[model samples]
Target: MGADLYRDGVARLEAGDGREATRLLEAALREAPGDVKVMHALSRALDAAGERERSVQLLELVHAKAPSEPEPACELAMALLERTEDTRAAEVLAPVLAAQPDHPGANLCMAMALAKTDPERAKAHLKPASRSADADQRAQAAALERVLSGQSPG
Candidate 1:
């Protein structure tokens, strides 16, 4: 029931209905409380609403609630990255990559974070991302793949 509402919120968010998505996601969160997926949606809605701090808070809650789940960790890393907190992003994504060596987003994110300060480490993290089975990986893998090929990532 609550999950359905959250799913609808996600659909709405993807459809560009940011306001409705936020409302629906909030309603779902009220019902499900600590549900990871709902929290994820709420974070996204808040971020899309330009409430970056609130989104970060929500995702931190998700991270606290599901320490072993890579999705929230990855999202948190992304949020931190947006803030240009590259070191923190690297810290958050490192363990995720260690746990799932082939995780597309984690690998790409970690690589992206490491790129500026340490190009070699960035290349190391990005190797698997280029070959990831996930389609989202392709877009992210662009710079990394180029970097690993001795070309400029940017």
Candidate 2:
């Protein structure tokens, strides 16, 4: 039941029906309390619904519950970065980066977090991210690379 709701919620979110996604995801969370997958999906739905604070809070819980899991850590760090919480994003990303330096998403988030304070470190992370199978990650890495090199991100 919870899994079905979770899937439907994620599908709705992907379809850009944020409100419905949030509703379904919330119900899914209730049905499967403390389910990290449901929590993560709900966080995305909340963010899409403009409930940034709630989204970040849920992501924080997801990360805390599964710190060793790269996906949650990367997702939380990305959320923190969106809030301009670079320090906390970097802190949250530490273990994931340490564990999987080659993980595209982790490296990308780490690069963004360190871009302002440590361009060199950011560049190091970007190296791996630039080679990611995901085109978006590769493009973002390229853009950040341009920014770090004092060129406009065009």
Candidate 3:
């Protein structure tokens, strides 16, 4: 019912219109509180808008609601790492990787999660990430390789 607006909001978020997405998603959430998809999309919108902490909260709730789904786990893990909560990120991502090893985005994210604590191992995973068919995965893997080669990832 109300999810139509939420889905539209998600499309807006993906299109980089975070402000409009937030307004629409918030309106949807008000009507359909705790809808997992709505929460996930709105959380991503919040992250794109630079409201990182709030984004994490929305994603955490999503994870709680959908334990078997990997996207929210990936989102929360990256958000945690961005906030310097690497240990927590590892805790969340471990099961995800165990369940879906070939998920390119998850593997790339795992490599990033390991980069600060274990450079050599991260490089090994980053190699596969670079070869992944997904462009985003390849880009992340290449960025990691650049850093490992002693160049700035920037």
Top lDDT model: 2
Deviation of model 1 at 10, angstroms: 1.9
Judged by lDDT against the true structure, how good is candidate 3? 0.81
Question: What's the count of clashing pairs in each model shown?
Answer: 0, 0, 0
The candidate scoring highest on TM-score is 2
Give candidate 3's TM-score.
0.80
lDDT agreement with native, every candidate: 0.83, 0.91, 0.81
Over 11-85, each residue of candidate 2 has an lDDT whose tens digit, in order, gives 999999999999999999999999998998899899899998898899899888887567888888987888899
**TM-score per candidate:** 0.84, 0.92, 0.80
Model 1 TM-score? 0.84
Q: Write the per-residue lDDT of candidate 3 for residues 1-154, one digit (tens) a residue.
A: 5777888898898899988898889989989898888888889888888888888898888877875467888888888887888778767767777777766666777777888898787776676567779887798789888997799998
Q: lDDT of model 2 at residue 3?
A: 86
Give the local distance difference test score of model 1: 0.83
Query: Model 2, 118: alpha-carbon shift in Å?
Result: 1.2
Candidate 3, residue 96: the lDDT equals 72
